[model samples]
Target: MTPLNRKKERLDGLAASTAAPAAGQAGGVDVMDPVDPVGEAGAVRDAEGVSLLASAWRRLRRNPMFIIGAVLVALFILVAVFAPLLAPHAPDDRPLIGQISASTNPIPKAQDGFPLGGDEKGRDLLSRLIYGSRQTLIVGVLATLGGLAGGVTLGTLAGAFGGWVDSVVMRVVDVLLSLPSILLAITIASLASQPSQWTVIVAIAIVQVPVFARLLRGSMLAQRSSDHVLAARSLGVKRSAIVFRHMLPNSLGPVFVQSTLALSVSIIEAAALSFLGLGNPDDSKAEWGQMLGAAQNLFDLYPHIAFWPAACIVVVSLGFTLMGESMREALDPKSRR
Candidate 1:
């Protein structure tokens, strides 16, 4: 071979030899593929990077508390949704006076196809409870939404725009926070020109607004200084886009979890307003609290009437609480499960 050919061959061999060990090193580690921290970090992040909602749902399904809550809530929802179908009797229908003897008293127990028997007004207790679930759920859910809508608007503006706006908003929030929620609700509801369902919902919603507003504001403030938000700012994204599209969406996990909890509170508040004669006073409507209030006088003679509604309120409230607590746990980054 010519000297040039030999030199070319030698160079090729040298290059192959240098590349071989790097490709298949003794320790099984790749010398050619040195660790790139940024790339590795990306991988690690992706590995942990399921969407928040999806991750929360996964955890929720597995959590016993969530399962229990979901089941109770679902059952209640079904009962509420299918109230008309499920109620065997008209909620306001009274039993035949002669059919049920006077000796049995106004409230009967576990007879005449009425499993839970009759209320003071002789309406089927089970039927009333079933129908009442509908009104309770409507009030609870609608009131919570009202609060959430108002609160989100106030909180987003206050947190996203800081300084004087935030100061004014937070001060108002503080004032609201200082008062007892129930007491404030009572005051507001009582002040209404006519005590009705709307007043009760408005009162409960007004009480909840400060709670959600403070929560969202704090969450937003914390996220506003975060790396992603700063990056969005650097990219010349509009403040509105960064706040609504980025910061708001990211900070909503806590709000959603709290909203579930707030539903239970709203239910209780609405019920209390009704009990206090500030809500629907129509005895025919079959509201749990109203039923209880009507039965209060007869408690000594027929405690069973109060028992059913009270139990319902407790169980439904507990269900929402468990759901909220489970959500809080699932959303927390530090939680192993």
Candidate 2:
């Protein structure tokens, strides 16, 4: 072969060898392959995008304490809602009046149709207990709602304005906080012309106002210094919008938890008021605390009368406490796993 032709043939062979390996390597793996969203890496991306409240809820659903608390709270609500259907007899009816003997058995023994027997007034105990759930639920929810409304207003004003406004609101809260809860409730209740269910609710609500106001104010203050709030301010967000939309919303987490805890406290406080004769004066309206108050005179002989109502109060309170505590833990960033 000629020298030029030999050199040309060698260059062609070298180029072919390089091109074959490059093509093989390009065909070996596809760069456009779709990712599996259900895989580990995808899961991590999803987790990173989850919201704080949503993450807290996810954790809450897994907690055994949360489950137990949820169940108890649900049960209480069900009982309250279905009280009319559940009570075999009218709560105020005293059909078992003949069964009672003041000197002997002031309260009737358990029997068919009347499983829990009769109270001091000879009213069907089982029916009264079932009906009491409704009253207790009402007091708890209304009191908490009232207190929350008042507290949120004060907290919002204080947190949003700061300086003089904060000092004024906090000083008022401090005064309320200084007073003993029960005594404060009593004083409020006494101001009313007559004792009624509403009196108990209002009294409890007033007593709780300070607690919620302080909590929300503190939370709002913390959020005011947070990155998101600062960013919103830098972006020229309106002052009112920043306070209500940003600060108020973020500050509500602790307040919500407090509301749950406050439900239990309200119930207990209602019972205390009732026991002190500040509850509904009408005997027809059955309440657990009222029952306890009426039965206190005969507690030595008919302990069961007081036992049933007191037990209901304790169980319901425990349910709220469990739910509130679990929620607090779930929402706390420090407690997150």
Candidate 3:
């Protein structure tokens, strides 16, 4: 063959040989063919979500404290909801005209139709406790919610838009933190023109806000630099939308933990305020703390009067605290191990 023709023929043959292998490879179902990396990654993410949920459930179920806490909280809620029906007598109704202090009168038992005994006035302790649950739960839950809302908003804004804003916000938080929370709450409560139930709630919420703000800010700061946040930002998402939709949702694990713990704190604070005469000033009100306060004068005489209310406070607060700890453990990625 001529030199040019031979060269062309050889080039064609090489091309053909390369094309044949490609076609053969395409026809052959190679079991070892490379997987789609994106699909595999998505599958891994779905699996991770399922596994995380399962782990959380397993951990919650296995935690005896969490179970106990849940049970206590549930019982309290039920009592509160059914207080009117379940309570044997009006919470504030003074049944006995004279002092019923250890008169050997047949005290009512729960099985005997009144399990919790009676106060000095012969008012039903069980009834008071049941009614008191409503106040405690209301104040605790509402105050925590207020704190959560205020803190998360401020903290997320500060962390997401760090600079002068962060400095200003954190400084405000620091200033609030400088004061003793109880003192501050008491002062605020005392200063209100007409303090009511909501005033106590507001006071507790204010005291709790700084704590929640600091915690949420820390979480937001950590999440702000995550890959998903960066990716969302790169997609031209609005700062507000990104902060609320992406950053906040991902950081809720920590916030939820803080919220649970904060509820317990708020409840205790409310009780303290009530015990100190700053909460629900109406004497006829049947709050647990108010009952305890009333019983303080008679503590030397009727210890049972204070015992039940104090026990309720301790049990409720402890339940929330324990639940918070368990939730924290369940939510913590590192703790999953």
Candidate 4:
């Protein structure tokens, strides 16, 4: 045989030998070769990613602080939503011809249907607190959402379209930043005169917009230069589409964190404005701030008058703050490390 034929015969023999079944087996399958080293490594990496996410979820579930915060927030929301049904008495009902701050007052009893005791006006303190939850939650949630919307829009525009647009937008932000937030809110509230709930919402939104805008701008600036953004650009994607669809989704982590923190601050601001006699001027019976304002008078005579309302405000704000911190840690890739 020629040298080439001899080489081919040897290769065929080697393949047949490799495919042969073990001795004593009539017809057994051939043993498969081990997977490629690179492919095996990739499979291990994919498995590790899934395991990491599961471990993170398990750790979060085991965290006592996060659990307590979540429970408190849930309870507060339930009470707020069901206040009218759960309250033992009408929030605005008062005793006949008696001041709420009277020291030697009749002790309220279930027989009298005043289970949680009465305020200086003889209105049920527990009832008012329950009702006040509705106002606090409404103002807090709405104002925070408004700020997030306005801030994210302006920040995304400024960051995506640098140069004169960015300069002008950032300059406007700086001007707002120079003003004291509370003072600016007070001025806006006063100018509106006997501000309604919507008016208070607008004022709080204005104060918060600058914060969101600044944070989003920073995030956008960083993301705009990333490899994926450049890759999208190279694929002939429109600037607006790339920014909104690709970059914005990646930038939402910081925006979510800021929104959570800002919600707590907005609630506090709503309370302050109401306490100063600026919010919901028409609806005296519909606000926690207004209740706090009323309670200031009976502070010395009936401290409980102010105590319950003030405590509610503090607890609600703290709940948001704690939730914000926990969410920030969870959503941030750096924090996971």
Q: Specify the highest-TM-score model's number.
A: 2
Give the clashing residue pairs of candidate 3, or none.
109-114, 109-115, 110-114, 110-115
Candidate 2 per-residue lDDT over residues 1-337, each given as its tens digit: 9999999999999998767656766999433324634333554333357898899999999999989989999999999999999999888999999988888877888998988888888899999999999999999999999999999999988888999999999999999999999999999999999999999999999999999999999999999899998999999999999997899988998999999999999999999999999989987989999999999988987789999999999999999999999999999999999
Clashes of 2: 0
By lDDT, the best candidate is 2
How high a TM-score does candidate 1 get?
0.84
Flag the better candidate by lDDT, 1 or 4: 1
Q: Evaluate residue 166 in candidate 2 and report its C-alpha lDDT on the 0 to 100 scale.
A: 98
Reference-based TM-score of each model:
0.84, 0.85, 0.80, 0.79
For each candidate, the alpha-carbon lDDT, in order, equals 0.89, 0.92, 0.83, 0.79
**Taking the tens digit of each residue's C-alpha lDDT, what string does model 1 give over 201-297?**
9999999999999999999999999999999999999999999899999888899889999999998988888988999867788888888788888
Q: How close is candidate 4 to the true structure, as a TM-score?
A: 0.79
User: What digit string (tens of lDDT, one per residue) describes model 3 on residues 222-307?
Assistant: 88999989998899999999888888887777887889899888988999899988888875568887888888876885677788
lDDT of residue 216 for candidate 2? 92
Candidate order, TM-score descending: 2, 1, 3, 4
Q: Give candidates' CA RMSD values in order.
A: 8.6, 8.0, 9.7, 8.6
The better-scoring model by lDDT among 2 and 3 is: 2
Off by over 4 Å in 1: 1-49, 99-104
Model 4 per-residue lDDT at 45: 36
